[model samples]
Target: MSSDQSSNKKKNNFTIIKDDSTDGHGGYGAGTISLENMSSIIVDPNEDKAYVDMAAMHARSDVERRVKWINDREEVQGGKLYWIVWVTVDKNENGPYYAGVAGSEIRVNREIKRAYKSMAEHVKHMEKSLKGHIIVEHMDDHSKKLLGDFLRDYKPELWENSTEELTRQLF
Candidate 1:
């Protein structure tokens, strides 16, 4: 595909808020959190780029697929840093916006086939994002900019509708 087509396809991987699965019926799945609004954004600081990678939702993104996970960060010395950002979209009176954004860190050493990431932290961040919290303060400036630019360029309307907090932190 052409560059524009490729870009569009990458952008299309992001998930937008959808109708409630429970639909106010309050039945079997009522209390469960709906993930339709969430998308996983992978930020690769080494490459200075970010993109939505839906496989990341299941810990199967390209950067993560072949590595063996290690519990200790020290074990992954010289590993490249990456961020899996959970971005949740929601609609307001004005339009759809990025209502939640939380970044979780991961370090990978491709040559050694080793990676370090806290599953607990990732789960917590996901929950926090689902609740509309912004938790990207831990990310580096470059990765933050990459994420911000990706979000803005992928869908300008959503970025424009996002809160000042998102803009202020990302920019």
Candidate 2:
């Protein structure tokens, strides 16, 4: 499109405003996305306490293990799912493709406003998928508790971005 048309498109509808610091190759850094949006912390596969606990639980009797599995799975599915919607300069493109967990909600319109709040021009070509569904497996109480603790203490940034209702449900 012509320069005039491009400018008009931005003015008429929402478009990504590039962040001056963005390196143009997905270098937006972990800072741009809120902590709530992160699906999980990367635990040490071998030495993590949560991993050790989960392994023990998975070996239990069938019925007992099944119940625990279902409850744990619901934690993420029931909470607000988030992703980054990368919109290209060309409006005709199908994406702004998604890059996050499996169950991220695909509805575009619902999250547009929320996404704009944290958006930067470097990512203007892409929109943040603020609302969506995420697919994750069951984790044990130890895992959940560890994560909750991290959020409550180490990663408090998400607290302000999250709604009280979401905080209760997630944490």
Candidate 3:
């Protein structure tokens, strides 16, 4: 393909999620934009997941609850529901980056990483030095992966060598 096509492809990495309001029952439905100027759809508590929607599973309550209740409903990877909310961030007429999907794990991973970094900094300052080391424990493999995937998925600039591996198993 041409260089422009290649660039577009690279920018298409993020999955866009807009606001969805029809997920009041089974928690899944089509999307309709409420605002005109908005470029994406947003996912709400009572709405279903959809392309262009910025969706969140309440982490502890909503996501776990729904993923279980609708076990394997949209099964993709080994009977597990796989929902990919797509978004188009067109850079051509719009700007430089356009059309993509936003990985929720990415957002979550950043959040945890920020928290971890902050905690680590606080500890080092309080203890007078980070001579020992830094690490995040207590979480399970799944939780770690959830955050790891986000890091590896979106924040590639922040990942490298052992850092990626450490965070993969830790955050």
Candidate 4:
């Protein structure tokens, strides 16, 4: 095979075709993007596991409470459920990097799987005196609303009950 054909074969082996209609180009355009090349899709399990550990290390009571609150609400709606929300902390950053609520442990695991690189980079910008730490925060009302909005927009299928149904049931 020619070098160009070999390169094409290698590229084709790694990525699946993506439909980018909702991605602002109208639909299938002249050129397509590859999902595998996306920064978020970390392929190495070991690297991902490391990030999950980093996330767990900072799991605080309040964070647990937040996870519980949402999990409780979802469970009441019935069927198997496992959901988690995480925050990534850095020494210099002013705000918590809310990892977002994940529907499953695996999904949550993926969020942190490739975090070490960025976390390490953040450390380089930190002062010598302050120590960096990671911790999980309980979802406050705002965070809860954010999660609700995200689920509605991105993962509506996860919700068996609508907000109206939930409010009616709870209240």
Pairing residues by index, what is the TM-score of model 2? 0.26
Per residue, candidate 3 scores C-alpha lDDT tens digits across 1-171 of 899968845643344334566765645554433221212222221232222222322223223222323122132222322222222223333243312222222111222222111223322322221121223343334444543454344445434322333543445
Per-model C-alpha lDDT, please? 0.91, 0.29, 0.31, 0.27
Superposed by TM-score, candidate 1 places the C-alpha of residue 113 at a distance from the truth, in angstroms, of 0.6
lDDT of 1 by residue, 4-63 (tens): 989766665676545468778878778877788899999998998888888898899998
lDDT of model 1 at position 119: 98
Best by TM-score: 1
Relative to the unseen true structure, what is the C-alpha lDDT of residue 93 in candidate 2, on a scale of 0 to 100? 35
lDDT of 4 by residue, 40-96 (tens): 111122222111212222232212223322222322342221223222222213332
Instruction: Select the stronger candidate by lDDT from 1 and 3.
Output: 1
Candidate 4 regions exceeding 4 Å error are 1-138, 161-171
Q: What are the root-mean-square deviations of the candidates from the true structure over C-alphas? A: 2.6, 21.1, 16.7, 20.7
Clashing residue pairs in candidate 1 are: none
TM for every model, in the order presented, reads 0.88, 0.26, 0.23, 0.19
Score candidate 3 by TM-score against the native: 0.23
